[model samples]
Target chain A: MSDLVSRHVGPIVLDGGIGGGAMESQIRFTGTAVPLRIEIDFPHRMNESVVQDIDTAIDSTDYTDRLARQTIAAGVHRTGTCAAKPYASWTAARGERPADPTEFAGALTLRRMIIFPDGGRNNPERVAMIYSLPDTSDEHPIEVRFLQPSGPELCPVNVRPRV
Target chain B: MSDYDDLGGLVARMKKAAIDCYMAEDGFNPHWNDNQKYAKWGWAYHHYARPDANGEGGGSPLTATTTLEAQGSVAPRFDEIRSTIDTILTGWDTLPSGALCRAPQSSANAATALLGGAASVATVNDSDEIVRATETAMASLNDLAGSFVGPVYDKYCAQLLTVTQNLGTVYTILEAQYAAQQAMWPAAREDVVAICTSAAAAWEGRAAEIAAGARQDSFTVVAAVAGAVATVATAGVGTAATVGAVGAFASTTVSTLSSLDASGGHVSGDTYAEILASLVGALGALNETIAAQELELNRWLDETLNAMSTQLADYNLDAFTLADFSAGDGSSSINRTDTDMITTAMGRVEGALSEALRAAGAPPVSNPTPRPHAIGVGLAGTHLAASGVYDYANQCLQSTAAEYTRGRGLFDAAVADYFNTDAESQLKVTTLLSQEALIAEMGGRG
Candidate 1:
């Protein structure tokens, strides 16, 4: 079984996440406007059974619907998938290969994505993402996490001062 | 021969009468050249209707035989001859006054000398003499004419041909009134002196008409000659032919003036002075016209020659030495230094040649298009390429030759103008000096 871990992808705002999780933060917008690219990496070498199951789960309509809803909820909209690598020896086993299949060292599927902090999904203010595998073997299986906004801060002292 | 045979024959007989009357000195010979001695007398016989020749004709009847019938037979003939001469010379009676002759001659001589001196010193010749001479002559006439007081003074005013007829009428009225007054006061010496003064003034005033008439005649001759020059230039006559024409015209003027001098009826002092003035004015006018034309021709020549010199300097052919081909290594590539030298030299040659074309009034040669230096090939190949490159210089030379051919006509015209004008000026001055000498001799005799 792969160990799943949450990572901070961009900037951290303590109370500025969707659903306000303490450790979760939204990606900071920087530079020129562009589509964000979200990449998901799968294990390079796994058991035949595990690989079959993961492929089946990714192909399921219900699972795709769930992933899309989660991204929308996080204030990010998925635009399109990035182009696959050229047909070469290294990229031959990436994506789906059912007959006489071979698995890549680590396969990354890139998704074109965007973030709109001001609510209207039609216009996105920030769009960018970068993903890398952890150097340590124990840091395998990166997981995508959701952020929530904390509503407001309250202060106990309410005495009015003279102008 | 019948007296009415021909006008020429009649004129010859009249001329003989004039010579017999005025110029028949002890050993006077009647050659074509000697005819000048009787020119004034002939002029008087032809031009003046008055038979007395202004007291110059020795004795009336002018016949060798003094028989009454003989004198009577010749008197009518002599009168007829005088009338004919008058009709030819002035178409009226009465000669212009002695002062008229003196003023124009003196002024014109002074002006001619001034002009000749100015022309000799002038770097760029032009005509300033005509205006100066005209002013001087007119002023002199005015001064002489102003001193008269009576009817004779009115005659002087009348002779200023430019004066209105109405002025003459007014003067006539004044003269009549003066005469009536003199009759009433018979012993008025002041009135007699005034009349004498007026008569002298009238005589002096005629100088203005003489000067004006002479000036007009001179201008007409100059205009005619200039027209002829322009016609000859247009016709593309060779320089020699044009020069010949100018010489011929000048000779004709000299001959005409010599004859006028020979017709010896001029009254010695003032009349001779007027004739001298008229000749001087004519000569001054001719000199000014020719000098102006010569200056213009010289300007063209100077401009073209200067341009040629500048262009030759620009070419600086001395700097165009061929590069040292002897040191070439047995390699296929050309030396960069040699190529550069040839290229620079060729450029200069092309530029100089273009300037030469322009000086000749030819179309400018188009600049050769620049080509990138060819990679060093061995000496033989490099030489071949250079030869090709130099083709542009050769083309420039050809173009220059064509242009020079086209420019030849202008060059010839300038040459013709220079020589012809120079000749005309010399002729005018020479003729004028001769006439002045003659007038001086006549004045001395008087």
Candidate 2:
């Protein structure tokens, strides 16, 4: 019955570099925000691959469900917990894209941020507090802008697997 | 009669003779202008092999050609001639260039049919006048079926080019990353340059030698890819530098492939000689695909395949057509299967060979190499930037892939579109993605 809590981090200036090259570069945060983990939503290679699949789903609901199940089984698991309490849920990847773009929500990465039973002890998610936003659309622009969290409620999200 | 009229009389007599031969032999006669002096029996095998003919078996086609009844010339003689020509050409009735074999000769064949005003050579026997149109169609169909292949090969090749370029990009990016890591140590850009340049040159040098080694036949292709590390190391550069060198070499190879034939030409032991002449064309298409992002291959393939499919779908395989086809004596089919299997097998060999070649070159330096990220004194120091340079250099490979993937896509699409072959497409994409994945893993360890 409580309103969902919203926490903010970042506006950490990214290093002047293009591509994944500057991904590992450190981000300097604002004084109020504790320097948290950098959240990198890497674009998935299959964004376009799934586009066609989604289109096909319009024809057959059962087929779509079957494909969805298959994808989940084949997919990498990402999870997280709320830092204040280890309350967690198995969250699916979500992306915010505008039919036409003009906002931050409109930007996306093929990667996703999922919350699990315990934020994460040992998994794609490193800690209870951090979770990443998955990029699932071609329209999403992948920028490794720094993730700064307010109060420890939000931790650094799992941006990607280590290279 | 005067001598000039006498010549005209001979022309008339010869024209009547060809018509007479067709009617007597096949029970049909094609159209002709008795007034015309030249023998225009391009339909007949005897006519096709006349003196001053192109040895590759294609010749300059005429502006006014007919199918079974083009130009409203549906008489028995015209139909017979059209049918015979269609049988001989296999829906390939034109020769765009008289001197040279066309790139991906199949495409040229289709183009020829189109140019001859046959609406496609399959339409060459659309009348009752030509007794063996069905036979010609059947032979054409068989020829077309033998040429069908999946898109896997194109994808595989694209993957190869993408991975190669990706390696090059990483080396260039990481060299700077590594040198910057030495800020705490305070090293020279020149020394750094020396290390970088030497390594780069060595890798490039090896690749050049290999590329140059592609003599008149039997390209080594990816034979030495895996040994890249050792090759770079011996040139007096460290592991990081060696990466750059190897990257350079890979980039060169990818660049070389961009310009390959886009038309999806078939090559077998028997047709290998023809393929040799088309080597430059195929290379050109590959290069174009490697260099461009948005692909437009579907149209070209559709245009070419549509005609062949239509013609072959309606073929009958008469006596003469059967004879010409059987002359191949199943050698063409044998050659095709052998070549397809060989190419497929070669595809598998590439990854292993590449890995081995690189391993032989450097064999990993004592420990498995790990890519370094950044080792800064804290976030604010310029001198501290040097720590993760090696890591970045290694990581740069992924970035390079990002940049050059567009071209690979285009090339893959073109090949698939040209031949409607998924094998070609799969071949290019998978090979490239795997290379990138392996390199990223290797670099991460370093």
All candidates' TM-scores?
Answer: 0.16, 0.16
lDDT of 2: 0.24
**Candidate 2 TM-score to native:** 0.16
DockQ of each: 0.00, 0.00
Compared with the true structure, the alpha-carbon lDDT of candidate 1 equals 0.25
Worst 10 contiguous positions by lDDT, candidate 1 chain B: B39-48
lDDT of 2 at B123: 17
Q: Scoring model 2 with DockQ, what do you get?
A: 0.00
True contacts kept of each: 0.00, 0.00
Candidate 2 CAPRI grade: incorrect
After superposition, the stretches of candidate 2 with alpha carbons farther than 4 Å from their true spots are A1-163, B1-150, B179-184, B188-341, B344-349, B352-446
